[model samples]
Target: MSQSNLFIVMSIIAVISSQPVRGKDCVCELQNSESAFPESKLSRVEITALECIRNISSEKMTEVDRLVLGLQHRLQQLNENVSMLEKEDNGNLYGAVSLRIIQLELAEIQDLLDKLGTTNTNNQQLSTEMADQLRDMKYTIAELENFDHTMVVLKDQENQRIKRHLKLCEEELNATSPPPTPTMGNCGLGQMVNVSGAKTYSLTVYGTSYSFGAWGRDANPVPGDENKYWLVVLSSSNVFGHFVRQYNSLSTILLGIGPTDTHISSSNPTTNTIQGPNMVMYENALYYNCYNTLNVCKFNMTTRTVTNVALPNDAGFNNKFPFAHLASAYSHTDMDFAADESGVYVIYATTSNFGNVVISKVETSTPPVLSQTWSTTLHKKTVTNTFMVCGVLYATRYLDKDTEEIFYSFDTKTNTERYDWRIHIKKLQTNIKFLNYDPRDHLLYVYSDAYILTYEIMFR
Candidate 1:
């Protein structure tokens, strides 16, 4: 790679490192089978196996990419180390087996990285080249592991472990490429770099400071209410709490403050508490993830009646800490609810299943049912937040300290995902706990800390 390209890659690493606000004890734990992520409990696909394939492809690709990039960076450091050692010993380190192994690893990384840049579905040649590289790397690692003749014990042990890890990643990646059928969706060519925004004043709420986790605007015009918008905010609690605030575009005052009520009583006492910080307003009803439970709650705006509909067992929930609301560390939302022109939908990521995005169309009745379910290749963790515009699912990525980019999109109409588009938004704050795109007003609501920012979307 050119020096300029290396500089760009390093800059991206720096940005990613700074974006996540962690405690001093937090460290980047290796994401292997023995790490934080459990072995993926991918479920069998009865209708279409597209999501499964995509899950395997995307996860393996990400793992291999990260490992290869790290290898390249380490190789550079090793080269410098080798040069210094040579200087100290009058060029005696040239014949070191550890140095030779490092050289071999660097060569393999260079080849794999080159393949990664040009490999695509359309190009059979590039695809074959990548597959060959993976196989070669796997073979090379096995060879290095068997040869146990190294003078530098520490370097040999580290390099061997790294090679073994890389081999495992490469082998996993090799199994997913060149699927049985043709690729259905392709990522966009470039980043959606153009974004502009303004901080529309924050609403001053009366009473003690409450840490609100979920916030959404009911953009669809209510029959009796014209130009009147309904904003719903939920505190970070599982037992029972919520507020419905009314807003008019002309006035800055938020008039109505809730029918502050508790309808969280459930037959399953263990799952009675609400575990979600995500809620969506559809028609006149408010839909939210019923936390610590495998269900979604639909609260009637007029009647104030709440009904619960059980989600599929695979639908994951992340309500670990009781009474944990809007805490930054516990910010990973397992399930999300969204509304669009067609109707309301529930979105979630699952570990028991394929670890892909599962979206279900909600049927608004006494007890709502999922009319239809849609699956996508995109994983849930990679996305920070998701919202629908004209039935299209756009997901945001927490890219950097100063930016949050729209890196992926799913066309619900065709059940395809485009990964290439990266629409960059310059952020005033580092952490964006909640984001909701109001299609009716063409405004993106970003909630971080005590501020609520509104950004106008102008696509060219």
Candidate 2:
């Protein structure tokens, strides 16, 4: 590539670095079968697969992810639909539509009669066809993976070429472009000569403490909600704080939308009508806890109607054994719930006679019914706490010269039933009056008395 072309690529890299919160495609190189993830057992080909992933563009990698999600959802729907045909033989209206597609219904009554002594529809035919369709789906999935790898390689080449050109152009502009001209509502943008920048738009969702500057008492809403995905703002009073909940129709959250305490009046529905409003947009339906009851539910944003999922009995909606008064008995510091890449977990204080601390987790995967509860007193500081990005948990507690608590990492993997312990404790920044986990990046952020302490986590 020309010297100018190389500079262009470097400028693009600078832009990528500017959005540091996005860790996707952060690895510059690929991993493969030979060099697969730090797994105990790996095929030789895994290194190449890792290499392919490392070499690709972040954009393409996300695209493939979206496609796979779409595919999985479609497959799930198909399976659910197919399962509905179960009661067809009885010919009841409950499954009337489904019955027509039932195994025996697929053939003529006369053909069924002539079949054999035991007309147990071999379905060997359908099985064969099912196998074929499965193969096709597998093929499509593989194609998507290959396409992701190919795109990554291509983008790297394009970026390397574009960087050289960008750098040269940037230098020339610095030397020749007229000094920046200031404009309204612009923050430091006019200072950058010719590199155009967009005006940052500020959308206030909630109020901050400075507004109420009303001293004596400040309350931060309890923010252990991984399912609802919330921002927990600590109050000036230190004892009281409430979480401001918002609707996240899209799984992805925007970055740098500074904390807002303004109340969001959702037009969708009332809280009393539904259980705990832990709203999560699942493809189409909005899944949540009904009035914070054991009955997990779903609401369609389009229809604004609650949906009843066919889950196990343990997912019952009532004053069940577990939730009858779990909150009341637990420390009053309202629990924060979070759903990682795996199932949902409750972050709360397991108030035993012993000193109260912060820690909670999910022991099972199925909905409505959880098999176990993992609780531990991770820190001695027991004032207030919340989970931030990059899987780090932060808390605020009394600080004695002899003892102080800061931040820690609990678990790393996405899905796990067994509590294979992986906890890291490192004494960190004090005076973090407030802390919030930004979904945009995996950074444990804290608002100390002064500037923001952005803790960059290094994952193994």
Cα lDDT listed for each candidate: 0.58, 0.34
Q: For model 1, how does the per-residue alpha-carbon lDDT over 131-212 read when each residue is reduced to its tens digit?
A: 6655655665554444333435558778999999999999988876565542222322222233444424354353224434
lDDT (Cα, tens digit) per residue for candidate 2, span 121-213: 343453465566556556654544443433776688789999999999989877876766523112211111110011111111334332110
- Candidate 1: list runs displaced more than 4 Å: 1-194, 203-211, 232-240, 248-250, 253-274, 319-332
Each model's TM-score, in the order given? 0.51, 0.28
Task: Report the C-alpha displacement of residue 81, candidate 1, in angstroms.
Answer: 67
Q: RMSD to the native, candidate 1?
A: 28.9
In angstroms, what RMSD does candidate 2 have relative to the true structure? Answer: 29.1
Which candidate has the highest TM-score of all? 1
Off-target runs (Cα >4 Å) in candidate 2 are 1-206, 209-332, 339-343, 352-372, 379-383, 388-405, 409-440, 444-460
